[model samples]
Target: MTKKDDIVQGEGTKSGGLSRRGFLGATALAGIGGATGLGSLVMTRESFAAAAEEARNNYVVHPGELDEYYGFWSGGHSGEVRVMGVPSMRELMRIPVFNVDSATGWGITNESKDVLGHDNTFLNGDAHHPHVSMTDGRYDGKYLFINDKANTRVARIRLDIMKCDKITTVPNVQAIHGLRLQKVPKTNYVFCNAEYVIPHPNEGSDMENMENHFTMFNAIDAETMEVAFQVIVDGNLDNTDADYTGRYACSTCYNSEKALDLAGTMRNDRDWAVVFHIERIEKAVKDGSYKTIGDSKVPVLDGRKGSDFTRYIPVPKNPHGLNTSPDGKYFMAAGKLSPTVTIIAIDKLDDLFAGNLNEERDVVVGEPELGLGPLHTTFDGRGNAYTTLFIDSQVAKWNIEDAIRHYNGEQVDYLRQKLDVHYQPGHNHASLTESRDADGKWLVVLSKFSKDRFLPVGPLHPENDQLIDISGEEMKLVHDGPTFAEPHDCILVRRDQIQTKKIYERDDPFFASAREQAEKDGITLEADNKVIRDGNKVRVYMTSIAPQFMLTEFKVKQGDEVTVYVTNLDTIEDVTHGFCMVNHGVSMEISPQQTASVTFTADKPGVHWYYCNWFCHALHMEMVGRMLVEKA
Candidate 1:
């Protein structure tokens, strides 16, 4: 055989024919040529420039211009809110909210429980609807509000630290889906609604012949971020979707009288967009005509006592989203099973609320057909509304100018242009301005499935977020961000407008005081690690020191109430520890020099072990303790 043939076939020794280095060099040259040639190859200067431009746009971030806007996205069942930078399309941070995130020791940390706190009955949650605080209807960038549907709670995340500050439970509510911030008409309360039907307040009713009421909407205070008042409604309040506050507080309702069968599907004819006259409820509160219920003493509005506080505007299919215009002249709603978006004039609602129109029927204005399964609508300040089509995986841009014209009886159809997205899209939100107007520069489309769009990530595919450039006439797909878990909803605010801090003060009581100084200040940091038993109440102050828990064992009797106060003795920064008791639904974090506590009832007798879940030191696994509970 020839020398080249022998070398290629590996029939010749390295010394007899081609050396290893020479063979590798020859193969690399041939491989490069073959790669460039391909089956049929073509390259041009224009093509090269276009390719280079696309790469630069996708990866490059100019200095001093970090990010134009910040998009707060819900992490769904992952129980967190993902903070992403727009334009750059970079994930800035993941703020843990309604779940036990072991990576950051969020729920595992003791002090973090003040934020992760919820009913012991629920260990996790489906976090949805990340609504930022508004000032005069504009994104204030101070506080962000998100709802936990699974746990039935609302959490307030302070933007300064990018951490959850407080989590308030919604008593007697099955699921919380609709959450929105309202600042207009002089009230600054975050509106939260129960998505599912439950029995009337204090009724002790069951599913069989249960009196279905919409229940009270817990209006959480903006400053304190607590559930302040509840606006109770009387009806078979089915699932409520995206809500807004403009001329009146409005929410889209699904499957009340129009039950979508046993499978809980969407119906095209029975859904509605309901408006609540919040002022009437405020008057009821002023007149002291409200009743309190449950341990929280949540005020409930007697549906039988007041004039009708709710007005229903019947729309097609299951309306999943509602968005008011920047001018507050109109509000748009799209149904999940319908092909159209119903646009209602705010003035018509005022007329209805004034009792000028009949209250027996739903107020219908205009139903402009957009696309199949239109799920959400967000307006651009440029007089256009973008609606996401879930089934079609496309976003339809409709003209609100034409919608208003059509409402004025001028024959103008509203659907303008439809842009294609990656997969099944859920919710789409646009960047807002001072007047709560959509900036029209960028629109984020959250899609559900990502079968072949990204790398094959096994059975559980990464969620796809399509960043679209809507600055020009045509919507251009700018970038694709692969995200973990399902992102249900998102809201955008300017990055420069909001402020965030990286570290807490070293002397701050909750997160910063030194362990030695705190103990000296008389906060009860006893080294003996005593479990004080007062009758059935057991109090244990557990301290952390590097590789071991100071209190290694907790001896308690069953049916005893146990309150464990956890304290961290570490003086070093970022050396936080977490505490989690298995199967007891107790988890919390203790920062350096800080103390946090968790309380639970030791109802069953068994030997249970608790450990530090935070991955800090090398001997983190060794920081464990045991709880021995004897039968009562």
Candidate 2:
């Protein structure tokens, strides 16, 4: 056939001709079907150019080009921090913190058990808020702190190493929901707020009467991660929502004193924003009298009783988010139960405290109605704020100054625009621009549901993170990323600002680099995995290689406290090993050529299998040993 005839076959063409039917047959032979079997259809140049532009916009990556921004999101109920690349919306890493990770053997090795801080009371974690380290009121890219809602602890993840280096489990605190790292004026502390109220240390008070009481942990020594002190917040303090650290130094002079807390109740019990004066609270802790809840004495900060120092301002119903502008002139909060985003003048707070203005009369400075169920609010350096609406599944952009002026009878437009997200959106993080002159460009909306948005794997669906472009006049929904677990909040920073460490030195204490140190610590690779029994304590020292644990069997009494020290024999990085004692609630990571230890009381007498969880070799599944505990 002629070439022109073969190229433009219409109807009644011969066999093997380039007609529509022949093209369809060819595509069928190549296994192309359904909507994708459109090779037979002709496309216009304009349509092709549009499709090519979309493909280019959604391009995964260049050969060696790094992402422009880094996103650190909280892995709720997973007890880990998920790291992703912005604009690209690609998941890069998952740092195990306060959780059991079989991939990296976290909490499954001796060293990681210490990192997990497991005790007689077995517990997992639900990470809620992930806050990036800030310096001078902006992301410093040095560390990220996340709070475990289930276990009531805080983990400090070193950005350089991309791993959790420190975990501070506070005593006498329960349901820690909010964590804020103070950095604007260089106050080295992380403020953690508890949701539910518990009795003072060693007290068994009735929860009904104690519902008004709350505890806040003062995690000092940010460089070292330590709980310097604990303070009592006496009020009908609802589940504390997000906190904001003001940029300007207040009367207290320290940046920590000006921390504003959104005292919100999930049950919509009260509507008040509590302004904490850290300096006064610190003084009360130094010379404050204790009050007895039931039997234990707690330093309760009751402003009515002159025991604490905190001022309250009435806001809308059920405020879920609170943030300060870049200039520290205004504080914004979103009421999930109400559609309005309330903006409170920071300077007017002093008037409210001085009794010049009453909450019922003049509490709210500016209340601009936005959308249904606003949960979080983030700022771009330019007088604008973006808030997430859960019920509406959208983000509303508004001008902070316009909201303030609207309340002053200027009749200005506070809401600039709104962009729809997939499913139910929860919290959001904008590109780092929480400064007076920052030009907020992008926003990542963390949603709660992703039904029918991606391929279904099981009953539990992955959450969706929608990337929105806000550089133009109107907000644009650009991309959708699927996240497996429930993500609560995220923090974004420029890629160039981050400096991560590729690997840790072999001699690190968490992963002993030298055999001499392991030997000096009584952890030896003796033949048969020597077990030392002394009274109620039993210690086993063994070494691990690929697909095998040198000591395959262990025996202990039901009441005995068992300590297993496992060392990795391999010298290559990433060829790590893990020890997980099934049903005993014991796990640890033994890094390559490193040693780690895990200790637990074998209170139950049963047969258990301990295995390597790092997936190091083909026979990694068989790298298990028998563990038996007999009745004492």
TM per candidate = 0.73, 0.72
Cα displacement (angstroms), candidate 1, residue 110, comes to 2.1
**lDDT (tens digit, per residue) of candidate 1 on 1-632:** 22332222111232446445335433433343354342111112233234435644764567766888888999998889999888787888898888776555676554575455443446677988887776667666788889898877888888876778788887866677778767564337878777766654546655454345445556777777667677655433332322234337777776645242644544346566677777787777778887776666766775422357677677776677777777676667776778888777776776787878775233566677765788888877888888888876678777777765776688665655555576789889877722455678788899987767788868888989987767765455667788887798888888766876544443543443224433543446635466777799887777887877998998999999887877677877678788888888777666676666666889879999999977669999888999999997
C-alpha lDDT of residue 88 in model 2: 79
Candidate 2 per-residue C-alpha lDDT over 551-625 given as tens digits, one digit per residue, 9 for 90 to 100: 999899898988787768776667778888887767656666666677788888888789987778999999999
Best by lDDT: 1
Where in model 2 is the C-alpha error above 4 Å?
A: 1-60, 118-120, 198-226, 229-270, 287-300, 303-308, 348-364, 433-439, 506-594, 598-632
Lowest lDDT block of 10, candidate 1:
38-47
Sequence-dependent TM-score of model 2: 0.72
Query: What TM-score would candidate 1 get against the native?
Result: 0.73
Candidate 1 clashes between residue pairs 3 or more apart in a chain or in different chains: 108-588, 109-588, 109-589, 110-588, 110-589, 216-231, 268-317
Candidate 2: minimum summed lDDT over ten consecutive residues — where? 248-257
C-alpha lDDT of candidate 2 relative to the true structure:
0.65
